[model samples]
Target chain A: MIVIENVSLSHRDTPILRDIDLSLPRGGITALVGPNGAGKSSLFSLIARLQPLQKGRITVDDMPVDTTPSRTLAQRLAILRQDGAVANRLTVREIVGFGRFPHHRGRPAAEDLALVDAALSEFDLHSLADRFIDTLSGGQRQRAIVAMTFCQGTDYLLLDEPLNNLDMFHARQLMRCLRTIADERQRTAIIVLHDINQAASYADRIVALRDGRVIADGTPDDVLTEDHLESIFGYRMKVEHMNGKPFVLHHL
Target chain B: MPDRRMIVLAAIALIAVLLFLTVGLRGNVQFVLQLRALKLLALLQVAISIAVSTVLFQTVTANRILTPSIMGLDALYLFGQTALIFALGGFGYASLDAGTKFGAEVLLMIALAGALLWPLIRTRMDMNLMLLMGVTLGLLFRSLSQLLSRLLDPNAFAIVQTASFANFNMLRADLTILGTIITLAAVVVSWRARHVLDIVGLGREAAIGLGVSWIRTAAGLLLLVAILVAVSTALVGPVVFFGLLVAALAERVMRTQRHALLLPAAALIAIIILVGGQTLLQHGLGGASTLGVVIEFVGGLVFLALLFHESRK
Candidate 1:
């Protein structure tokens, strides 16, 4: 579980997040969706402790983020930041293996290697495992990064803008991968998503923010209404229910 | 492949050592051998200290072209040397024990390095901007040293002048033991933290996400780099491009970014270059040239080649 209370952040006296209070329970995926400048990424950074907490307290699984040992927090929560620039010289396998660093520190035992291999296969990355990350395409590299995040063996995964460089096909593939990880492992993932349709398709719940404030929160269908979408995005978008799932024709 | 390359480098370094010792044997062989051995140890210490320092600095900054010298470390070292002479007159400096001076300088550099670099590291500034800042800081250090140097007595200024150039023949045996201890401790610490260095290459957020306390780790490595740079500079003056030279070559030789391989490989490469160059100058080539000039020449070319290649890519 992740709990955030009265968290506010500012840069150069310009408020970025204003008094955000949220409590998330375990075992499902939560999608944070909003347009640019909506503080989606900023809020995700705070949960992952990428940025320091400015005003209030945040806890991951009852351990306060500010005080928790990074190594201890790393075992419970893993984050893939938005601008994740990987070391180019490292092979995909080596990169994925680093996910176990918090657990093993540096020495990888048999169990750690086995888990890395499993993550590679789960992400369909076995063939590219030996390839250098710089040689891979952007989408392939993104998958490798996601695979590494999964290999962390943490309960809570925070991925900010994981679909940035992915094409349509790879984007959906990644979403399906997230769904499997959440459903099968009962892992709780909070992803910052720009594509509302992807969020509608995969998210168990949707939290909408506008200008650093949480404007709407509920199941996809409940919070992704035409009125709610207009308020959050400042524009109207068509919402279609296909197989009891809300699909937003956001491009229209 | 990495193991094979490392073995080849070790072999070459061994040959360089043997050549440096045996190239000119005459006149009381035992006495000459002991002197050569001492010189060999000093050279090795310099090589290892520079190689390890450069690698650590590059890793913490996540940059390929950066060396501690570029970050104003050795410049600050030179500044420290000049300042010491200015504060303590030439007679006082000449009277001070070499080990005490080296120890004091190392402490001072470490403290100053932390003060100047901690904010930039903590703020997570862009590496290039930091590079620009470092270059600017280095200029400041160089200029201040120059200004202080101008005010010194001619005799005191000569002492400052001696600290600025690279000279291999005048190895201070008194300072060699202190430098070797610090260099060895740094090497061991760096070797133990090799895996962490690899993660550090993944940049700030990812390493922090991987459980690295980025600020603490970077600060520690920076402190270590400061120590090695100080030892190297204080021992044998400032060798600007030697660290950059050996480190870049070591990366190419090993063909991987793994510090476990890069650290040893870089140090060995430094031995091969420094020892090999000194031997060639002292024996192979008529004793007409300085090893420092030859190294700076070749190292400058390597730096340019790297920049050109990076631009092409």
Candidate 2:
């Protein structure tokens, strides 16, 4: 379980996140949905310790995020930021291989290589594994990056907008892959998503944020109501039920 | 694959050394050989120091076009020497202990580099800002050194000029031994941290996400770069852009990002260039030109080409 209490962050004297308190349980998918400038990414950065904690405390499975050693935290949690750019001229396979660094620290045993192979196939990137990242298409590159993050073999995966640059088919495929990983591997994934219906269909719980505060947190049925989304997204959206799932008409 | 290339490069460097040492032995064999040996040692120290330091600096900065020399270290070195001559006079400066002089120059370079580089690294701002600041600082130091040079007496200026130029003929055995020791230590530490350096080349957030202590690693590598630039500048008076040439050539030749391979590859290339260029200058050119001038010409062209290539991309 991940626990957050009174976590507030300000950049250059302007508050980005404020007085947030929440506990995410183990072994399920949680989607963080919000409008633009809603501070979802900042919250993920704080949890990943990319940005130093300015106020309050967060613990991952009873281990404090701030106090734990980096290697220890890395083994338990992995994060993929949206703005990550690969400037090293590395091949897809080589980039994915770096995910095992915490486990092997440059001396990769056979098992690490096997895990890398598994990640490559898991993301349907086996054919493009040898291509350089710069040469790959945006959707292909996004899949490759996700493959690298998944190769870390962490229990908790926090991905901030992993669907960018992906086509609808690839995005759905990736969401399904994440769902499978969560259910089969017993790992928890907290993904920041913009698509409302995708989150409604896939996430076990949806956490809606507005102005750096959680305004709604519950199952999709409870949080995907037209009233709740209008309050969070600042617009009227038609929420209809299909096969016992809420489908949002926010595209218009 | 890189192993085979490394062997070929090592072989080439060995042949260069042989040709350099035995190509033309004249009047007194023993006396000439000893002098050439000292010069060879100095060349090796400078080559290793510059190549290793530049590669590491580029790794930490995540830039292929940067070197420790870019941060005004070599300019500061000249300023320090010019200041020493201006204060002590030519004769008094000559009388100072070589070890003391080398020690003082190295300390000053390290201090100045630290002051200029650490704050930027800590804040993690736009890297272009850091590069701009480095170039600006270098210009300032060069201007200051030029001003100092203008004020000195002709004779005093000559003394400083000889020390400032990249000349291998004035090798001192005591300073060579000291440099060899310091360069060897820095190389060993750099080799030990080779893997961390590879991870760092991935950028700061990626490195930190991979569990690397970003501040500690950057600080440690920065100090190592300062030490290396200090050693090479003290020994060779700064062969500007030569490190960029070697590193760029090594990356093209090795085709690998692993520092374990890149370090040796760059070192070997530096040795080949220095020793081979010296041989060509001495024998082929009949001492018509200096190796430093030739290197600066080639390195500058390569730097421009790299800038052009990157901009187009």
Candidate 3:
């Protein structure tokens, strides 16, 4: 379980995240849904230790993020930021292979290679494994980066907007990939999502944030109601139930 | 086992060395060979130090276009030269022990480099800010040097001009021992951290995600790069574009950024360029100090081409 207590963050005198307290249990997908400037990415970055935590304490399975050795934390949790880039010419396989760096530390044994190969196939990246990341399409590159984060073989995956640049088909496929990891591998993934329907379909729990605070948190049916949607997104959307799932007609 | 590309680069580098040593065989074979050998050693030191430092720097900055020379380190060294000549009259300056002057100059460069670069690394300053700072600092140093040059009496000015000049063909061996020691140490440390350097090539957040103490690690590498640029620039004056040229060429030829391959490829490429260029200048071109100009020309072209290529992409 990941625990956050009274976390508040301000950037240049403007509050980015307010006094936030929450506990995320192990396993399944927990989706963070919010509008722009809602501090979703900021919260995600603090949890991943990408940014320094201000006025808060966060622990991942009883290990404090601030004090734990980077390698230790990396072994337990991996994060994929939205703005991932590769400056040099690197093949998708090579980039994914670096996911096992904590284990091999530059000397990759056969087991590490096997894990990398498994991750490639897991993400349906077998055909594009050897392709250069710069040459890949945006969706393909996104998948490749996701594959790398998954290959870290960690129990906790924190992804900030992993679905950006992905079309409908690829976005659904990527969410399904996350679902498989959560169900079969018994991993926990906290993903920042903008597509309400995608979060409703895949996430076991939905968290709604607005104005730098969590306003609603519960099962998809509980937090994604019409009124809740209006309060969160500043627009009323019809939430229709189809096949025991909430179909939010946000586009309509 | 060395990669095949590395093998080819090594072979070419070796051939360049042989040509440099044997091209103008004359006089007492022993004396002439010894003289060429010292020059060869000096050039090799400059080549290795500049190439390794530049590669490490570009990785930390997360760009192919920014070399350590971009940090105004070379300009700073030149300013130190002018400052030294200003304080001590030409005769006093030339009369001082070369070893002391070189030592003082290197120390001053490292001191300023620490001041300028350390905080930027610690705070994770934006790349654009760092670049702006570097350009602004470089301009200030260059202007200061020119101002000092203008203020000197005609005799002292002539002395400073001759003293501050970077002559590739006639390098003194006074500081060769110390420079070699520093360069070798930097290379070894750089090689030891080769794998970590690869991880750092992944941007800050990615590297931190992958278990690197991003700030401390990048800062350490930046210091190493500073020491390297200091040693080389102090020995041969500033060769701004040489490092950028070699590093970019190495990446293109090797086709990857894995430091295990990239570091050696860059050093080898630098050796080929410097030693080969020196050999050509002495034997083929009647020994002009135009090697520096030629490097600036080629390196500037490489820089522009890289920008164009990136923009097109």
Candidate 4:
């Protein structure tokens, strides 16, 4: 379980996240949905320790976020940001191998190599394993990054809008992959998703944020109500249920 | 599939050994050989220090076109020298021991680098801001040095001009020894931090995520860079773009990001460029011109090529 208490983040006097308190239980996919400037990325940044905690406490699986060593945090949780900028000219396999750095430092053993190969196969990146990351397409690069994060073998994976720049096919494919990982591997994933339907379809739970606060949080069936959507998005939207799953119709 | 790095390292070692041998073979002129050896040592020290420092700086900054010289260490050295001359006339400045001047210059350069880097290290300023501050400080120091130079007599001005050219022929033995020691120390420290440097090249956030103490690593690398720049600039004055040229070329040739490979590759390339260029100047050009001018010209071209290549890609 991930516990965030009174997490308020301000960057240079501008409040990015205001008193965001939430508890995410272990297992399954929890899709964080929000409009632009809803502090979704900021929250992820704080959770991942990409940004320091200013006025709050967070714990992952009973380990305190601030007090725990970074290596310990890295082993417990892995984060994939939206913009994955790599400075070096690294191959896909080598990048995935970097996930094992906290575990092995620089010297990689046989088990590390096996894990890297397993991650590459898990993401269907076996063929592109030897190729340079810079040469891969947007969707392929996204998958490679996801594979690298997964290779860390962390219990909780935080993906900040992993669907960005991905086509419809790749997007669905990635969601399916995440769903499988969560279900079979028992990894808890907190993914920030822009597409409402994608969230409604695959997410076990949806937490909506607006104006730096959580406006709604519940199972998809409960959170996808027209009234809740209207309050959270500040716009009227129709919600339809097909095969017991809610689908939001927001396009005018 | 050639191991160009190994070839280059071998070539540099060969040239350095030949130079060492040539100095030894001049049996009758012990004083000349000793002087020549000192100059060669100074050159080697400058080459290795600048090459290694620039490569590390580029890796941290994530830009191929920048060198530690861009952070105004050269200007600071000049300013320190000019300030000395201004305070205590030409004769007093010239009469001062070479070791004293070298020590003063290095101290000033390290202080300047610390001042310029402190804010960036303390806070989370963007790279552009840091670059801007460095360039601004360089400009300010250059203007101050120019002002002081203009105030001096023609004889004093002449002394300043000679001091600014980055020539190794006049290097003092004591200064060279001191520089050698300092450069080796910096290199040893940097060698220990090599693995962390690989993570640092991944940029700030990712490096932090990888359990790298970003601030400490950056500060340590910057200090190493400062020490190197100080030692090299004291030895060879300042060849601003030479480090950039060698580091960029090394990266292109090696096609790898590992610092273990990149650092040595850069150092070897730097030694080759300087030693080879000096040899060409000595033999082909008949020792008519300065090596700094030639290096700066080539380095400028390489910098432009890198920028254009990056943009096109």
Task: List TM-score per model, in order.
Answer: 0.93, 0.93, 0.95, 0.92
Give the CA lDDT, 0 to 100, for residue A245 in model 3: 87
Clashing pairs in 2: none
Q: Model 3 TM-score?
A: 0.95
Q: After superposition, how far is residue B22 of candidate 3 from its true place, in Å?
A: 0.8
Q: B101-200 in candidate 2: lDDT tens per residue?
A: 7888888888887786677667755556766777898899889989999999999999888887788987789899889999999999999998877778
Model 4 chain B weakest lDDT span, ten residues long: B17-26
Give residue B3's error in model 3 in angstroms: 3.0
CAPRI quality of model 3: high
How good is chain A of candidate 1, measured by TM-score? 0.97
For model 2, the stretches where C-alpha displacement exceeds 4 angstroms are B117-136, B298-313
Query: In candidate 3 chain B, where is summed lDDT lowest over 10 consecutive residues?
Result: B162-171
Interface RMSD of 4: 1.4
The lDDT per prediction is 0.86, 0.87, 0.86, 0.82
Show where candidate 1 strays beyond 4 Å: B83-96, B117-137, B150-159, B299-313
RMSD of each: 2.8, 2.8, 2.6, 2.9
Model 3 clashes, total count: 0
Which clashing pairs does model 4 show? none
How far in Å is the alpha carbon of B66 misplaced in model 1?
0.9
Ranking by lDDT: 2, 3, 1, 4
Question: Lowest lDDT 10-mer window, candidate 2 chain A?
Answer: A83-92
